[model samples]
Target: MMLDSETTKTYTRPISKAWWLRDRGHFNRRYFMFLLRELTSVFVALYVVLFIYEIFLLTKGPDAHTAFRESLSAGPWIAFHIIALLFALYHSYTWLGLTTKMQAAGRGLVKIGTKTLPPILIALGSYGAWIIATCIIAYLFLTL
Candidate 1:
């Protein structure tokens, strides 16, 4: 996008100096918070929906529940869960990784730090933390 002075001038919302400094010059910390919360919200919704489907099957009687149990024990569903987990992991890494690199949706490149470490390092750290946390959680659940 050609975000020249004229382009900025044509913005539907008035541009403030504070906004530019926050989003363009400084790291877009606000967006970081929003994305973090939004991602979690979406994940929770999906989880609830999946559980509702399972609950529905359970209520459908012994045959449906038995089939559901069999399907849950099946390899394909396990594969699907693995795929979903990996997808979420990758998506989170990419989203955070872009935080330091993404410019305003239409503005010029926004630099975050003077000697900013590459975003991949943060992304790698996030993935590592997620793996550890997920394992710990799964272990606790399984044991319980």
Candidate 2:
């Protein structure tokens, strides 16, 4: 005996191309921040590409590398660097803060003995390490 079966079509709601840009016909602070964070990632990726390109330029000879560095000192390039730096800083802050957020949400807790660490301490420790590393790098670069 053959069994009879009915095939059902799955329904999918069509999404607009700009759905991420629009949230329920309006924009909110949380949505705006989400977009900003995503945009920062683009800036960060561009920064990484630019850094790699700079490294590649070094292989072309000092003149070529110096020219690239000089061009980057121009007003527009300076502004772009500043903007990218801001975005990168914001991105890093949010990325590192995720640990604290997770702790607060009771999702990814770090335990010491039988007690879980608080979010504020987690945030401070992460940011503190960042500051220390930044200072050390800056010191080495400035000395060099």
Candidate 3:
């Protein structure tokens, strides 16, 4: 049996348009940085959507795609890209740092004889892998 609408109560909480920014009047540097780090995904998602739209424009012909590409080369787009890059880098760095912490916590799973590798080494290895992957993608793009 379904409950009657009259008996079922609904509650609503008023939320501010800038709710996320409401309590930032006294946030420490680290807390502010954490907020910025979390915001990185918004920029990253915007960039990805932009990239996909550019690819879609390619199907419209070279003229359409070239015009779109030239438009993106403008100052505003360039600045946006630079800011997005910085945010993306921050996001990646934080994620890699977390990875290092996880590895440190799971030291027993990756022991060499009787000693476990240091967290710094684990972080470095993760960063190295990221760099290598980036280089490979760049190389492929340049060559193709």
TM-scores, all candidates, are 0.40, 0.82, 0.77
Off by over 4 Å in 3: 1-25, 105-109
State the displacement of the C-alpha of residue 84, model 3, in Å, after optimal TM-score superposition: 0.7
Tens digits of lDDT, candidate 1, 1-144: 435776467555444465623654566776665565456646556656878998998789999988877887789778866765665665666665564354323332433665445555555665677779889999999998
Q: Would you list the clashing residue pairs of candidate 3?
A: none
Where model 1 places Cα greater than 4 Å from the true spot, the runs are 1-48, 56-64, 74-86, 100-121
Q: How much lDDT does each candidate structure score?
A: 0.64, 0.87, 0.83
Count clashes in each candidate, considering only residues at least 3 apart in sequence or on different chains: 0, 0, 0
Candidate 2 structure quality by residue, lDDT tens digits, 12-114: 4555566667756775678678889999989988989999999999999999999999999999999999999999898889998988999899545898888
Best by lDDT: 2
Q: After superposition, how far is residue 3 of candidate 2 from its true place, in Å?
A: 27
Ranking by TM-score: 2, 3, 1
Instruction: Write the number of the candidate with greater lDDT, choosing between 2 and 3.
Output: 2
Candidate 1: worst 10 consecutive residues by lDDT?
A: 102-111
